[model samples]
Target chain A: MDIWFFLIQVLNGLQYGLLLFLVASGLTLIFGIMGIINLAHGSFYMLGAYLTFWLLQSVDSLLLAIVLALPISAAVGYLIEALLVRVLYRRDHLDQVLLTYGLILIFNEAQRMLWGGDVHGIKVPAALDWSIPLTDTLSYPVYRMAISAVCAALAVGMYLVIQRTRFGMWIRAGASNRDMVAALGINVNLLFGAVFALGAVLAALSGAIAAPISSIGPGMGDTVLIICFVVVVIGGVGSIKGAFLGALLIGLADTFGKVLAPDFASFSVYAVMAAVLLVKPRGLFA
Target chain B: MTTFIAGTGLHTYYGSSHTLHGIDFAVRRGETVALMGRNGMGKSTLLKSLLGIVNPRQGKVTMNGADVTGADTHAIIRRGIAYVPEGRGMFHNLTVREHLVMSARPGNDGRRDWTYERILETFPRLAERLGSLGTHLSGGEQQMLAVGRALMTNPDLLILDEATEGLAPLIRREIWHVIRSIKETGIASIIVDKNVNVLLGLADRHVILVKGEVVYDGSDLTPESEILKRHIGV
Candidate 1:
């Protein structure tokens, strides 16, 4: 393969990894801090794509659709936490899995009823519908580069919030001791609700951005959800830094596996997870 | 003095095993109370019941005459109570600075008396190790940080459960010094420790529990008292 072609593949891998980071970071946060295994997390991604698609029928801008859809996703997430997830906090993991698995079925059915079981594609905004020339016969899409940049910026912003701000401190502290956090006069229930909503918004944002490039259809979230769990397992249950590295590794592995060995493409991500776990049984940063 | 917190008919349990049996406990404003008992004597359970950490099967917890039984722990804590739980309750992920800053809040009456600077001044050892994680601190330093973290909340009441447990002699003295200074600053405290000698000098009143019941509650008990030997085995 040509050097330019290799570079383009690497860029694609990085972009894919960054997008995965958006979804996985939230998953790890919710799991680590709240101790709730949310199987319905991916449904928010599907919901985001559908919400954006439905909004585009009335709103012309993809950015505006995302902006409008985020709070709606957050509200839905908050209500779910208050109504459903709160009860499971005191319950065991088996009960949590059962309830959230049921949520997945409900969300899938809801999507089928509302959007129909048909493939749909989102139009790339005209402003970003351009390419940067990398070679005489090859070029890279600016839209993909834009997605990587936005995800990267959000990652940095998230790091700063988790490290520097007071709320972020509570999140880190809550992950270790929920009772002590509440003893410090911080309302932990409200904190968990906000965190769940934030996770939904992140997953939704990933879906909205990726919609322009990929075919949006029923069960789009299932594939991504399984991959995100791989990312989380490789990264560690609760470490954001681990998630970043894990996502990039999985992205590059999956991206290159198809080019190098077409038959093994689907197995490459899990193989990487297995290899990482062999070295560190608790994950890279658990 | 006004009662800061009062628990009456508190019957707490853990999975059918009775812990605090209709315990009547109270702490007055600006007073230091020593909750003394041997291990498994329900001293901790009584504190947990008052702070809403463990729900009592039957009881009423009142704060300043308000019926606050079964309120959320954060809501109850927000009324100007801070707890340095057993084993220090340190968050391994947080730095010394993060632990202090995260818990910093004004008192319920809006008093910001316990500022970050003041805490650092009080515990200069903590100031030197501000960047270190809680797990990295020495056992003595962890106790100091725990006390410092509690003080940062500017609470009307500070609760320390085994504050100096498993610490060196020098370190235990340092914690007692700080607790003494805290009482001098007029913040009420509930201390549980094996050092009855130190508590004798520190606490204004004493309440000792034996097998889920208070066998002694008085202000005049001393090191030589027969009750201390019978209940605490001191």
Candidate 2:
């Protein structure tokens, strides 16, 4: 066991954990706050990557691509929520699953049709192209560290919004009792739309930031979506803090498992989830 | 003396089972009305129907001269109606303060009387538990929080279903006292409870339901009245 290799893997785990937090946080918000089991959430992440890809090519600026992509993703989320997800409020989980599954199929095919079947890579911003020497032989990418910083800032922003603003109160109240919140004269549908849009933006941002690190391709969202479900379940469905913690745990487990036992790496996160569920069935924070 | 809100010819159903049949009820401005009935007689259903929590298959509900029948719950509530539902409907995860703050709004009539300080003063027990979670409070405390939460909305009409159910004697009296104080503010109220003697003193008029039908509606009856015993008593 090389100590330097292990330390590098830990840094990699932190980077991966932060990225997972961005995606999983939105998943928790959409599921917990709006009571929608949206399987199409990952589609937003994929769309974000593609949108950033297109924008970066056209605008030739990473900052502009990010700025434009947020609102674009949010607008798409608003339309989808109003037109389709709104009808599913009174519906059972099975109906939601069927509809969202159908959406996943549509999104997957659409990506394939538009972008072709080949995997694509995005260049890291010129400003963050440097690396920091971790050991005598190993160096860590600055862009990965930047992902952690941005995710931390977003986490702080989310906490402030949820804890301080009137909008946040409505969300907290809605999460507890949708009917009661509506009866109190807060337009829950509007709140739902806004929260869904925020979720879309967050998911999109996750993809945007991660584009430089990972390959962008058709069906890229499927694996992330499954991992996020595991995160939400282990962290407690509605808790942002829980999602953050769960993501880190899975990130470390996945990173270390690969080096310790390569064959078990793929299933390690699931194993953690299973153990967490056995003790706290509702999730850690639920 | 004006009718603030009224529901007429209301027929509501839960899936295939009809819950309320042709129920007509009204609450006037500054008046206190008691809704009385046995279990499953549709007392709660009528309240829910008024707020659009459960839409009636037939009939109309008019509020402030507007036909609000089948309107969305939030829309109805925004029109100056607040409800304290049965089981208290307290959010298990929310703190007592959050419950109050979330629902706080100025009254539609331009009355800004029910502020946080006023609500806390009215229900001091709630003030002490401001930081406590809704699930942590006792039954009486939960009831107080629910009422305080409704008050914070500063609504024109406050409807409380099962107002004092599952309360101790002292707590029940305290609740009744608060209801009377609320009545003094000239806001209409519809209270549902089984404590006939206590309700008779506070409510200006009584509306009784028997198996989803109105058996009585008048102000002249008392706890000992024949009409009350005949319909409500076993």
Candidate 3:
């Protein structure tokens, strides 16, 4: 591939990598700290997209729709945790998988019924829709770059919370040794529930933001969810730093791999995972 | 400031293995009481039962005259009972300061003031490394942090199991310093430690268990007291 083509592909990968970080960060936090394997996490992403589709039509403004949908998404996330996820917290992983798989089905069918199977897209807010000039006949959409920037910001915020805040300590502590936290007079059940809600909100926000660039359709969440799993596996399961690096690596590889060998695009993503596993069985960051 | 925190006729199990068999025990308010037994004699199991972790198959647990047998862990906590269990149930990923915050309840359980700032003052080693993770600390520091966290809850009774099971002499002494200070605050404690010498010095009364039942309840201990040597050490 030519150098210009390679650079463009690299940026494309970065964009994908950034988005993957958003999803994988949530998955890893829930899995690592809470010991929960949340298959329906992607459903929250789908919920965000569907909400975007409906709200965009209702308000006729992408910014307003997203602004309005953010809190609503957070609330739905809380409900899902309180009603569904909490029930599975103490149960075996096999049962959690079965229940969350049930949630996946319910959310997928629910999204289809609400928004229909045909894909839809929200117009990027006018201010963010313009492209950044790179070369003659080569311009990148500002909205896609915006997705990368927004996800990057959230990642930084997540890092700060985990590193600097007291709640972050409890979260980390609860994940590593919950029994100790409980013994320390911490209401560990409350802590775990809050963490689960936070994970859901992140997944929802990722879906909402990506709506302008990607199709907001029935299975949009499923596609992203699989890619997110790839990100987490390549990062370590509970490592946020791992998720961040994994997302970027996967983003770059998937982007370039598709351009270099269209047939090997999917294989290339798995290939990187296999190669990383060979070096560190957990992932690049785990 | 403290009164009776007692478990009467406690029978508990983990799934199928029945562990605590009709064990009746009580710690007087503002008293330092020890729950002692050999390895796997249900010492930890008794603590777990008190926390409502494993429900008693029979009997009642009362805290400050309230029947807490049917209460959930948090409900029991809101009733002013704090538990520090064995093997240090800590979050390895969190910083020291964060550990304090996550455990801090809004307002005090009953204390007028038991602030996180006060905790840092109590454990200066933790203050120096405020951002360190749980595993990064030495065994003694982890134990100190555990006590600091329970203190943060400002409960009426602090239930600590195996608080000094494994530690250097100096670290154990440091823990004793903190524990004595806690008693000065008038927070009652049910402490499970192997050090009979320390127990005689600190505890107001002693609850000795042979198997799962209370074998001896002794009181009025002095430095010269040798009555505890047989029941406690051997």
Off by over 4 Å in 1: none
Model 3's TM-score against the true structure: 0.89
Query: What's the DockQ for every one of the candidates?
Result: 0.90, 0.70, 0.54
TM-score of each: 0.97, 0.95, 0.89
Off by over 4 Å in 2: A1-5, A278-282
- Give the per-residue lDDT digits (tens) of candidate 2, residues A19-61: 8888999899998887789899899899999989988879988
**Top candidate, metric TM-score:** 1
Over the stretch B100-174, how does candidate 1's per-residue lDDT look in tens digits?
A: 999998888899999999999999999999999998999999999999999999999999999989999988888
The CAPRI class of candidate 1 is high
lDDT by residue (tens digit), candidate 3, A89-116? 7799999899889989998888777777
Query: How well does candidate 1 match the true structure in TM-score terms?
Result: 0.97
Report the number of the highest-lDDT candidate. 1
Q: Which whole-number lDDT from 0 to 100 does residue A234 have in model 3?
A: 92
Docking quality level of the chain pair in candidate 3: medium
Give residue B157's error in model 1 in angstroms: 0.5
Interface quality of candidate 3 as DockQ: 0.54
- How well docked is model 1, in DockQ terms? 0.90
Regarding TM-score, does 2 or 3 come out ahead?
2
